[model samples]
Target chain A: MERIEIGHGSGGKLTRDLIEGLFLKYFKSPELHSLQDATYLPGFEKIAMTTDSFVVQPIFFPGGDIGKLSVAGTVNDLTVSGSVPKFISVSFIIEEGFPISDLERIVSSISKTAESAGVKIVTGDTKVVEKGKCDGIYINTTGIGDVKRELSPKFVKPGDVVIVTGFIGDHGISISLSREEFEVETEIKSDCAPLNSLLVPLFDVPGLRFMRDPTRGGLATVLVELSETSGLGVRIYEDRIPVRDEVRFICDMLGYDPLYLANEGKAVVVVDRKDADRTLEILKSHPLGKNSQVIGEVTEEKGVVLVTSVGGMRRLELLEEDPLPRIC
Target chain B: MERIEIGHGSGGKLTRDLIEGLFLKYFKSPELHSLQDATYLPGFEKIAMTTDSFVVQPIFFPGGDIGKLSVAGTVNDLTVSGSVPKFISVSFIIEEGFPISDLERIVSSISKTAESAGVKIVTGDTKVVEKGKCDGIYINTTGIGDVKRELSPKFVKPGDVVIVTGFIGDHGISISLSREEFEVETEIKSDCAPLNSLLVPLFDVPGLRFMRDPTRGGLATVLVELSETSGLGVRIYEDRIPVRDEVRFICDMLGYDPLYLANEGKAVVVVDRKDADRTLEILKSHPLGKNSQVIGEVTEEKGVVLVTSVGGMRRLELLEEDPLPRIC
Candidate 1:
């Protein structure tokens, strides 16, 4: 098997060959084809920019690999921020001796994911480290998008409704099980799809106040952050929150709180009570959001409180320690 | 010493504390203060985008650290492309148990370097891996710059002059010596400085055709690339190439070619013969470019050639292997 060598990252002939033969072939865009130090993008009035680094273990997962996750992760960030992602820049730090075939597979995944997310791979960089200096590969992606709408927690009001786009905690649960630390296995895969298309239509709805992807710290963390930042209160209903049975079972067995687990492709959206039903209708119309549900509402109280099915109120605090690392 | 824990990158309370306590304190900007998923930048007609991942070993070197090198590396790429760097996104993949003090020092260096480069650190992400899965830290910076001038190898032509901004191979040599593998000692320091202020002036100079920073593959590699890409010949005189006495001494002892070693703070420029003197004068006026020299000229023949001090003609090839890795 062909393995990467230090020369492949030396920015020399080997680097050139790898780029031209592998990356350029997969990421076919005029901006990248020019092979300049920087890619020039023309005509932008207002832009949104976000970045993320993916160091998830087990490069390949059930539903997605690091390549797909990296692209979707940034795209989802921009999407939640009410931006239309346009171009993305990817950089990689690969360990020497990493398989060339694995790299090609990842590159192909990146291309396909970027295409589906409706973004162009404009520029990128690659660096290789000595064998033990790095894990197999770590990818960093920065996305640029056109600001389509202004979304902020400041717009959230006491009577606003909170809606989750899909079943929560699937991604976190899938990664945990993939580690094989527990002998339990299930068919649940990560919900690591890009939410851009599903959520873009919601930007047209009136009273759309704020949006956030429940990624690393999950739905509860995002709600807590929203409550603190907006200086408002949140009241979520435990029974209304959507979670797959398998995820809930695994979380229960592992002593994890599904509400605090990560979700790669779901968004916690706040909209006016008057437009909540309309927003839900729009979200539920998309396949990615078919499991959408109104889970909570903004309140005059000051903290994030979950009203359980048994009529008990529990306060949700920001996560103090990680239950899982590199779940993204 | 306080050390980074996996919780610090969990995107929860600990992550928030780290961001607010360190990154936000240093990277003071309204865009970052918003803490939105993405930063919004208004009013851009044309922009240049570039990304790079820095994994330089030793973390700290004589003149700069990985933090400083990361910022300067991306900023210089934009500068050479004739852009005014305006916004930068930084992401770090850190190892668990890495010293927080070291991380803070690196961040301080990054903040200082970004400020000096006239760019805003608008958005970022942090991910931590298990202790042995990664080196101390790796930084990925993607920059967005306003395009002030169009530059390309397509504009280069025969009879154009090639100018180098300063001494070659300082960064590579400094890194090699820092490794302590050769039992050598020297006062040499890496020339890891941002070149925007120095090179931005040349953008206004008429007849300037192309510019590229001689970095990973160094001056010879850059010149060879220029020759191949522009379909023009390049003939550089060894006598005209600038090299410090210490650098020359180290290279001779180590059996390394200074021409192929990396430089962090220098640019190889191609310009019209009629404006060569003016370009040289302008470059010489800057402290960073005091050692600037017109070392070669574009020729009608097809390959890169070196005219040795003894008047022997020798061809230069693109570097096939790196003499030093992670020199940044």
Candidate 2:
């Protein structure tokens, strides 16, 4: 029955109680306990920083809520960038009159996700806007990590092979069905998760050229970027790219392309051809990567081309328009 | 006439163009120029981190806009915490169809502010929500700085002097008048500014115990917090507290307490009583601190007390409700 009031974000007594009763109880870090203006941390030799804002609609999706997505999204960005995420700062913008119980639930999710990812929630801020000024809730998480290695397009060569950590388009499809706008029913759950555990170990592996999360623009967009940045071509096999039958079915029914749909928990990695099989074996050994596949390879040409099962070639371009909004 | 489309946030070609054409052009830094998933920076021995989300309405207001406020808010937090801010990460959540021209103007403001604050915009993210799902725009800024000194209540002691850098409640009054809900008009402007260049020098001054920006809950809440946290009493003179006549007139008309109102560009500093005069002189030497005053002194008693001009005593409590929202 408890509801948030404007005072909860007024940086006053109510704000203090909410932080102590909810956030402090959930995110138990020594740095946060100090409640200083800024969290002071011991610095590393080199650090990586990234930021993301999650405005996912239908806050509670099949496999994840906005809290989980917020943490996972920032952690995955650090992970794919060849860093070990160590700290995260979370800021929330909530609408007035939102349920305190729901906020607690989201806070719990953020705590669990950060724990699983081995990152600490060190500092944060909260603001409340009057009704209709904002959506239910939006979370912005900024992550800092220790840079373990340097990964860049310059290291990617023509003979490098492209590997996707797991099936693509599940997240995008799951979100679509969750909206229930199309009256379509399916049991596909979002692949929303942190990639630090699955991808951080690969930083030590030899021949890792570059890695990036296939998020908003999906696998095809990542490949196109890789090609353009490295000035090398990419040739992806349409059949080799793993897409779940349920997801593909939903995409087909909704006139969507699985290749350009978003994925929350997958990574597109480019590795030297000589180490491609080793990388695949290492990836498949992990539970989150059980469905991993080597979907394509770098080429001498200068554009992204798909080799279809019909023995025809088609070029893929960066997505021009959005089919879905606020999908994380 | 150009406006943002849903496609601009799709992480596609449009997204690339926006980043390259708009963001990159303004936020010029080597780390950002690399266009990696995360920004890599050389680490310091110790660092301070903070985050804040700005949901200020009207987008633009007298003296500053959301962009300036976003950068200054985070930078000031670091400066008050005894750090030299070095980098900032900006993230935007914009509603679809928001004017690109307005966005560019905001970006220019951010660029200028960051440049003046001597911090680099190292990394960022953007998301666009459907119409009616959000206000025009919201910004979140996270800052990382090198810790130059340790400022905490643990170092605060009885007999310390409390100094407010300038006037209070200007930002709160300015925002209220700009809303025009009461149709009151005035030339008052929001005192939204970055305080790094002004306050960072004080870190070298001896006897500086603690400092904090009197932001959302104003000087009263901050003093109450200091009293509670340090287990020391504070007795401030009402006559010494700086309040502009224009701001006071509006507050009197609106039934608002200026002490509980917000300030965007001020700091409440605690210093050893012996060094109070020297600190005041130093503060008065700066343009931003010409109105600096020794407002009160730390006491042996355990609560905040106000000595009224009429020789009566009054007590100040932590703000219980928000008189204004989104003032920053």
Residues forming the 10-long window of minimal summed lDDT in candidate 2 chain A: A178-187
Clashes of each: 0, 0
Expressed as tens digits, the lDDT of each residue in B210-285 for candidate 1 is: 9999999899999999988889999999999999999999999988899999899999999999999999999999
The best candidate in terms of TM-score: 1
In model 2, the clashing pairs are none
Give the C-alpha miss distance for residue B58 in model 1, angstroms: 1.3
Give the Cα lDDT of each candidate: 0.92, 0.91
- Model 2 agreement with the true structure over A1-328: per-residue lDDT tens digits: 2998888899998999999999999999999988987999987899999999999988998999999999999999999889999999999999989999999999999999999999999999999988887788999999999999889988999878999998899999888888886666677899999999999888978999999999888888898898899999999999999999888888888999999898999999899999988888888889999898998889998999999989799999898877887799
Q: What is residue A29's positional error in candidate 2, in angstroms?
A: 0.7
Please write out the lDDT profile of model 1 over residues A1-328, one tens digit for every residue.
2999998899998999999889998998899999898999976899999999999878888799999999999999998898999999999999999999999999999999999989999999999999888889999999999999989999999999999998999888888888877777588888999999999999999899999999999999999999999999999999999988888888889999999998888999999999998998999889998899999899998899999989899999999888998887
How much is B303 displaced in model 2, in angstroms? 1.4
Candidate no. 2 TM-score: 0.98
